[model samples]
Target chain A: MSLEVNGHKTYAYTGNHAFDACLPTVIFIHGAANDHSVWALQSRYFAYHGHNVLAVDLPGHGKSAGDALNDVATFADWVKALMDAVGIEQAAIVGHSMGSLIGLETAARYPAIVTRLALVGTAIPMPVTDALLETSAANDHAAYEMINVFAHSPRAQIGGNRLPGAWMMGNSMRLMERSANGVLHADFTACNSYRGGLDAAKKTKCPVLLILGQRDLMTPPRAAKEAAASFSNARTVMLDGTGHSLMSEQPDAVLDALIDFLRPKNVTAA
Target chain B: MPAPKTYQLDTLSLHAGQQPDSEFGARAQPIYFTTSYVFPDTDHAASLFNMERAGHVYSRISNPTNAALEERIAALEGGVGAIATASGQAALHLAIVTLMNAGSHIVASGSLYGGSHNLLAYTLPRFGIETTFVKPRDVDAFRAAIRPETRLLFGETLGNPGLDVLDIPRVSEVAHEAGLPLLVDSTFTTPYLMRPFDLGADLIFHSATKFLGGHGVAIGGLLVDGGKFDWDKSGNFPTLSEPYEGFHGMVFTEESTTAAFLLRARREGIRDFGACMSPINAFQIMQGMETLGPRMQRHMDNTRAVVAFLDKHDAVEQVVYPELPSHPDHELARKLLPNGCGAVFSFELKGGRSAGRKFIESLKVFSHLANVGDAKSLVIHPATTTHYRMDDAALRAAGITEGTVRLSIGIESAEDLLEDLSRALRASQKA
Candidate 1:
């Protein structure tokens, strides 16, 4: 569904189900160079299983219309504005990679509105290598190739997607290719330049679930342990043999963990 | 950061899709031969049906064994996903139906396999779809043939026996300019020889019954989605962008950023068409495909030898392989098919139909049959066999003659294949 957020047209996938104001809401945020479709299976599950799902394509990323935000702080503000636009009072925020920082900043800034937080494939003070930034800045195809290689594990680099017939690596590559030329660079800049993650974790008061990939090269699991200490209330679910693309490589495992953590206990007060 | 070290084609062929069974530790891809799977409970069943989860409910929709083949093919083709079908024709049918419905039109190449010609020219039109056929080398002719109703522009990567190499980049330019997708038949030139998607084709299908299967034992096809075409942006395909009434009012493009085409192709076309590949056949094809790299190298080597013998022979009028400088699209073939123009090609005998019969009958080492891409060498007269249904204009456009004899050089000994063709050519001239 298309909604208005800060006057820019925003697209959110509701899993083909309409959002009811009475139900608790779950808003899914995707990582760099991706849209709401990354959460296709998970967001759809939540919508069907009694949550008002709003899997948004962040501004200038996917179907959403606007210029790409320059920093994580702006992205956090955009997420809060999106919820306000949709009349979603308080909701559980689920974010992956770059979006995780946005969720952390949002939770810290607006503790009254954030009921719970689930950080997927996240890290504190996420860093981008100089080589990746150069390639992405030039809008070269090699940057997409580099990220796709590192994002998937050796096991995932091969196959065995629970989703029949889909190739996870190829799909990830194509999704990055689909984004506009400068969107990826802007996203990487947001992640690399952000220093508010640990401070945000300290201020955040909501129950937190940190889902980390055991073999993730992009954000090492060691970072998640450091993040857990900063959060007042947080637990971790480590997916074995998975990579940075945990949502796609270990989709069922990720969803199962989400189902347990964000069970009825964490349902937002609508 | 370290440089990316993704697996190459040979490695992908051997190990791209299959994972050892967690239960019994079966290293080989196990065939899930059953028709249905048991769900853990009712919610799980509903979730599977609703596309809220990713598990197979029925064989026609998907099977673990077939998915191994699909994923492997997708990996090989650099596609987001693929669907395995009963035949090459079924894969072609699945692609067309998924994109458009009644009153749709296609601008296709005149130099197509007869089976493809039959579908686009005859059967599809019966259901209110129409096609305009143009020469594959005539890129402008493709653009000229497109009407307001046209949704697809299609051609073979290497046009059947004629070997008229389709200029994928140029033709795809025309399709993209008109907000359409270019679908190509890569049956003759498999991914081993040419990847159509990398060359700008949006969709590709292979007659796995031939080269991919190699042994001529199993009949199957693979339809791959390159996942590059923007169906949502095109506004030409409401079937993908709009809420599909056929399946829960779900917007397919909203489901997957890149794989919307494959999603709709599998969900609606494969489910309703009922032209699904069996797990056993999928397994058989995978067996041949595992050795695809080495076999293709040998297939190309044997072909070069056969082409050389036939090129200077007294009884041979002309050879239609693209490697020959005399062929019309030799330059284009060199540009596109860097590996080789595949193993299938046709040569005209000095005598006409009688000579075709004589040569076919005289061949000892080569099997006189309609199929190509077998482990054993095979021969056929396209005018009477595989392309029998095409009329004079279609036949001429496809570069076929009464004297034309097509050969699918296999991985067999080149010495034997050369002797067999030389003896057959001498016998053919007697007619």
Candidate 2:
């Protein structure tokens, strides 16, 4: 469904169902060079089961209309505005990689509105290499290829997608290729330049779950230490043989962890 | 900061999509022949149906063996995703139906396979989809034929029988200018000779029964999505962009940035059309693909020797092969098909239709049949067999004559193939 977030039209996949504000909400945010489609399986599952799901296309990234935001804080603000536009009082925010940072910031800034947070393939101070930054700035196709290769594990390149016949590596490359010219450069820069991870971690009040991919080179599991230590009620799960694309590479495991962590203690599926 | 060593085509061909069986540790790809997978509980069933997970539910939608073929072919073609269908005709039909509805039009090349020609000219029109057949060589003619309802531009990589190579880059330019995707049948050339995606084509289909299957034991087709075309930007493909009510109000383009076509093709087209490939067939094709690269090289080597022998033969009036200077698309083929212009090409016999039959009867090695891309050499007289449905003008347009005898060179010894063709030509002269 399309919403008027911050006076610009925002596109969110409603998990293939009509939006219902009556139910508890779950918003799935994708990483850089991607949109709601990255969370295709998870979001659809959540919406169909019990929750109201909103897998969004960030500004200028996909179906949404607007310029790409220059920093992580602005992206967080947009997420809050999206909730308001959709009449969602609070949502359990689930984010991946770059979206993980946005989820952190949103939890920090909007403590009352965020009931819980789940971060997948995340780290404090997510850093981009100088070479990747330079190549991305030049809008070179090599930058896309380099990241795609790095993002996926060697096993993933051989192809066993949970979704049969879906080539994970090839789809990742094409999604990156589909992004607007400055989106990747800006996204990588935002990840590189942001110095607010410690501050956001300190201010965050919601229960947090950190899901790390064991073989993730982009944001190594060890890199989650500082952020994990900051959260008073944080629980961490490390998946075996998984990569940065944890949602696709280990979809069932990721879903199991997220669903177990997010579902209310007393409530069961009716 | 070291880059990982990526596997090459041959290694990927053998191992890309297949994993050792987790249950039995079977080394080769284990064909899962079951009709449906069991769900653990109701929620699991609901989740699987809702696209919450990626595992298969029913064989008609997807099977483990078929998924392996789909991934292997996608890897070989340099495409984002693919779907295996009942046959080459099913693949073509799936690709078209996924993009078009009643009243949609297509601008297609005149030099197409006979079955494809029949589908576009007679079959599809019965359902309100119209097609304008343009000469594959005329780039401008493709652009000129587009109507407001035109959904795609299509051609074969190497034109059937004639061996006229379609200029993918140029035709794709015209298609892109009008915001349409170029869909090509890459059956003749395969990825070994040319990857149409790299050359600017957006979608490709192959008769796996031919080259990819190599042994001609399986009848299956594969449709690959390059994921290059922007359906949202095109504003020409609402079937992809708009919310489809049939499948839970899913706006396919919004579901996956690169894979909307395959998603819809599998979910709706395959589900409703019932033109799904069998897991056994997929397994057979997977075996053929393991040796595709090396087999293609041998096919090319033997094809060159056969073309050469046929060119200078007394009873052969014209040897139509792109590698030959006299062929119209020779230069284009040299540019696009550097590996060779594929194994299949036609030659006109000096003794009309009667001689064509005699040559077929005279050949000891080459089997007389209607199919190409078999490991064993094959021959077909198109005027009476493949192109029998077409009238004289239609035959002329496809570059077929009463004496046109098509040869599909095999990976056999070049000396043997040359000897076989020479003896056949000598017999045709006497007839």
Candidate 3:
């Protein structure tokens, strides 16, 4: 369940390939600092329950190649091209944090291509603090810590701070070091500059889902709620004790929500 | 100097919602951080609770800081009154719930923020209410979808991520014909670009977390009542017209004429839901609102430059910005958001998803975050992100492809933004 998208080989993991051919596809876009591996649990869970799962390493973050882009539009263009390359005419997009914003751009620009959207741990036009940008530029350690603070639940934070998770963070940081500073800066800059709201959410003719970690400090649940308000067909689900890394923190819950969303309705038998 | 009769947006942004504090002569609206307001007497408390007086009762219901924000937004939106909520979703939920009951129905635009889409598509159904989604531009579709049980029509003034401009007037007409009120979520356009109430909407809602709270320091929502709809005539909104057991058996319509809907919303809806805006968040949003007009201008200018650059990019398969003639909704954008469509647009790469990923990875200026309406630039791929909940068929139906990337242009220097995009495009092609 994979294809070469835009000359770069892309991988898709469909847990259940025998589902109805007419079933919708669920595409997973990981965050700025992570790769498609972050969605391993999600892909398997959804695929097991009759879904066509597509998890991609946003170029430079995972198995994908190259460096980060400078502006937001180029990233969006690249995604559009990838969609074209995969021969996936369209699908439901779910993005976390940075991925969520990218999903917004894709749905907005290619309304004809995005049937539904779920923005997790992200807001329309994310707010950036100077401290955050400074940390990303000067102190990778601080940046990682800040990101973890924002992404993990308070309980996870306390737990991760103690033993195995702390070691895991160390490993993650080493991997994140390979990510170019340019990409991190551009991602934050794009988030800082993005201007999305109710008006923008209104134009698309599709349903939308928003998932937020109640304890997320990075892109707080409140912001997700605000962004969700703009859509006529939108719902907000705040996972208690969860943070920005909702897929990792509550993978089963996220999968269940997606499964429910992807389940075809009677459609009034039209 | 005295304030000009008609101040520009910049001037309005600074002074629109404020007056000198009567006791301290404070220039800025001071934050009244207290949770409860003291009453003059038992009679005064009764009067306030009875809707015969105008003042704060509890911070959870309303507060001085939150009230200042409500007034500021109401003045900016030219609405009769406003109620600030804990978050934008609460505002939307309260708006819909205020007008319709469990058995009622709604006709909504299909293009929507993921959270909102889920709320209408899934959660509301659990409450015994159902929604029929239609294209925002298809007035006929909306009209055709309306059922006898449909009590309200809803659409975003501009769609999320899609950046599609809604035909507010046309849709409003359709709703009015059905004796229904049109609720427009004006989060993106704000009062600066397009005022939904002025454009014939019965109500407006905003997720103050974005542009309104430009700094991203706080999260809040506001609901504005246009006082344009005649609930008595509609007969569909009994909550506003009928007696309520929650508020000492007071009838909202009889107690408050212009602010009946808002009053009922605060006294009953929010009280029961407990989705109250924190005074601290309200204060932070107020600070953001003070700079909204200027920030929006920069966002628009930057967006135009970015759109132009993307339109000419060699790797770009297409650019979908309403301001560009190439956009399918360009004409409609002109009619609606003539001042300028707010900053946010999308483009597709010629190289497909891999190229899209490479380009995203190649960025130097734009952050690869998933949020929009920031002071900085952002980029994302939709097939892998926001719309991933939909299966392939639904994705095709919604128009999302693997190579599609969504961009939220920031207020960075246009040259910087352009250079970043150019480099990424080149990198994407090479990759």
TM-scores, chain A, per candidate: 0.98, 0.96, 0.84
lDDT of 3 by residue, B116-230 (tens): 8899999999999999999887889999999999998998887865777899889999999998999988888888889887678988999888788877678789888876676
Mark the regions of model 1 whose C-alpha exceeds 4 Å error after superposition.
Answer: A268-270, B383-398
CAPRI class of candidate 1: medium
Best by DockQ: 1
Off by over 4 Å in 2: A16-18, A266-270, B1-5, B387-398
- Fraction of native A-B contacts kept, per candidate: 0.78, 0.72, 0.00
Q: Is the docking of candidate 2 incorrect, acceptable, medium or high quality?
A: medium
Clashing pairs in 2: A162-B54
Best-to-worst ranking by lDDT: 1, 2, 3
Give candidate 3 misplaced runs (Cα > 4 Å). Answer: A1-270, B1-8, B388-392
TM-score against truth, every candidate: 0.98, 0.96, 0.60
Candidate 1: chain B TM-score against the reference chain B: 0.97
